[model samples]
Target: MTRKTVRIAMNGVTGRMGHHQHLVRSILAIRRQGGLDLGDGTVLWPEPVLVGRRAHALDALARQYDLEHRSTDLDTVLADPAVEIYFDAQVTSAREEALRKAIAAGKHVYTEKPTATGLAGALELARLAQEKGIRHGVVQDKLFLPGLLKLKRLVDGGFFGRILSVRGEFGYWVFEGDWQPAQRPSWNYRAEDGGGIVVDMFPHWEYVLHELIGRVRSVQALATTHVPQRWDERGKPYAVTADDAAYGIFELEGGAIAQINSSWAVRVGRDELVEFQVDGTEGSAVAGLRGCRVQHRSATPKPVWNPDLPATEAFREQWQEVPDNTEFDNGFKAQWELFLRHVYADAPYHWDLLAGARGVQLAELGLRSSAEGRRIDVPEIAL
Candidate 1:
């Protein structure tokens, strides 16, 4: 097979998501697996050039990954004729400028979601990408999860005859740095820095609901900063301006109602840090990141409600576990492979900049809904 090498300029690879998920787990994993087979007597290999602002951090990461290419000058990397792709996983506020620059430089673009800080910025990026005719996409990694895949299979097989509702519970307590080091970054609590639970998580809910259930028509939300102040990485106290928790109720196109709760201040009492419960006429399912359990109407237990009596029913054991019929790869890597195929082979890819713009739209509307104390209608993006 003929081998083709594609150079990718990966910006912000020193960050947590970029370094662990995109670089080490996805890109390097693909390299270890002998590249992607195009099935046309050709294979495409990805060569990533680590790009970041900090010289010391970039040097450390490059040495850790044993990579030959590393650059602090983003303009130099972007101007390189050999570079075919430009990926950004930087902080939310910095995304648009870098992406716009990359698009202007004629590089195919991809990035992590809430694609931009606002709806207008996201739409502008999408429009520019379309006008430039550059291949682009945004990460919707949850769609590739094993549990969601099983849920999709069940939905396809008619297990859920006319779905009714979906409830998603996500989050865990993040310790303040005063006593213990905060698990998340300090920027996440500062509104000026583009940090908030609504902006960070509503995009995930939008895609999940749209893919597994139906399109969201409207949203009613209430968001709050549960922890008013917290210590930063340097042990200095800082006011928390961004919301740490968001409670949302969404109406889908098919009359299915979806409710999602995202918080960085909540304690965990469920099976996983995140879980989704879907109910339907024929059956019901509860899915986590890696596991899914289902209960058909036929197998549901009939129990009389007696508050004063001791309950003997094993409610949790009534549901059956979904079998893992196929081996599931890393969700980030799976999407990376598909994106590469889309760029190289012109494969059908739906998660474009337009889709990313829609995610930004959802987050923006969700915040408005919370502030106005009313439901906000979600309009489709024309682009």
Candidate 2:
């Protein structure tokens, strides 16, 4: 097998998602498996060049992992002729500027979404990347999940004949940082600091909906700061300006109504932290982060609504679990492998910077709808 080395300059690995999912689980995991096979007797070897603002953290990570490269300066890493890719997992507020710099430096770019704070900024990044003629991709990790993949399979196979509606429930209670430490960063609650549930998760739902069911035609949302005050990492209280919860109603292109509720204040009562149920004339399916279950129309149970009587039907047991025909790797890792192949092999990759801009567009529209307190039509976006 031929070994082809590709150097990737990774930024923001000190952060949790950046460190845990992208770096540790994805990139390093590939290296441990003796690199990714690109077929035709070639093995794609990824060399990570860790880059971040925190010098001490970067140094510590490099030393701990025995990584040869670590840099505090983005410009220096960008200048390196050997580095082929620039990967970002930075905060949403800081991503656009860094991406602009990377594109100007002529490196392939891959990043976490929301790619920019606003649709305009995201479009600029996409346009700039296109002008630079460099390969670019944004992480759509959830699309690669086993459950969602199965849901997509059902859709593609026409199991959902004339899809009617989709209901999605996501999120769980995040600690107020008083009684227990908050699972998320303090900045996530500050609107001025690019923190809000609308900006955070709407981007995710956009692509998921478009790929699984249909394109969103319009959006109506209510974004609210359910938790008014919360203690920070320093144990100091601060006003929560951003929304902790959002309820959105989206009209799909094919006339499917989709409603998704995202909340950090709500406690879990479902089997998974996030679940989406899609109903059609032929069948219905419940999809989560990992599991997908389906029930054909013929097998659907019909029960009379009787409030005075106890429900005797076993509704939960009616749906059959979708079998995993093939091994499912970590969603993050799976995407990383495909991206690597995309860059080296120039294979078909659609989730480019433009696709990322679409996510940003939906999020921006959702925010606007919340502010105006009305349903807003989603305009077509172009570079």
Candidate 3:
């Protein structure tokens, strides 16, 4: 069997998303599966060289995985001609410089969003990547999730005659580190460190809406720092400078309106950690991370509003579950496979650096709207 190995410099693998999703779940998983079968008697194998700031953690990960290369110096990693791709999963504050260096080195880049802390930096990366003539992509993981996949299927099949509106509920209670050791990192609560629900999630909403429903036209948002104080990973008390909750309304192209609430302070009250309810003229569907339930116009139930009477309808039972139809891989892993295919096979991939910049653009606009207390139009971004 002919085997082609693509060496990837995976920066920030010590981070959560980097370690679990990109490294273990995607790269390691692919290698464990005997490389990605490209058919035609060729197998594509990814050789990841772990890159991070922590020497101890990097050494530990490399030793545990029995990996060939690990480095704290990014320049040393990038200087290697064997490395074909530069994958970034670093904190937002540190992403731009790393990405610029990677692009300048003429390596294909794939990274987590917001690709930069601000829109300008993201656009700069996009433009630089284009100028350098290298393949680039941003992780739009939610687009590949089972719930969103099902939504896309329904949309493609014309299950939704006219997408009228979208309601998205995301996030959960991130315990303050003093007691429960907070499920999230301490940096996430500090605005100085690029931490905030709006900064974090608006990018995701932008892509999800743009790809699945429609392009976002404008946004109006209210962002709040619900948890004013929190403890860090070290149990040290700190002021929460970032907004823990953000409620946003986005006007989409084709007259579809979307409202999303992202909160780290809210306790779970729904079926999934994140859920989206899309309403169309013909039907309605509620989609979560792994489940989707739909009620067609024909099966829709009507309930009469009474001032004092108790409701007698089983509203939850009315919707039919959307079948998985096939096996679903981890969203992050699924995207990594596609990115690898794009890099090696020259496959047509749409989620480019420009698409990532649009996410940053939306996030910027969202924050602006929240600050100014008004609707701000989402101007299209270009490379």
Q: How well is each residue in 193-220 modelled by candidate 1, as lDDT tens digits? A: 8899999999999999988898899999
Among residues 3 or more apart in sequence or in different chains, the pairs in candidate 2 whose N, CA or C atoms overlap within 3 Å are none
- Summarize candidate 2's per-residue lDDT along 306-359 as a digit string, tens digits: 999999998999999999888889999999988888888888899989899989
Off by over 4 Å in 3: none
1 against 3, candidate with superior lDDT = 1
lDDT of 2: 0.93
lDDT of each: 0.93, 0.93, 0.93
Error of 1 at 16 (Å): 0.9
- Total backbone clashes of candidate 1, pairs 3 or more residues apart or in separate chains: 0
Residue range 28-63, candidate 3, lDDT tens digits: 999999998876687899999999999999999999
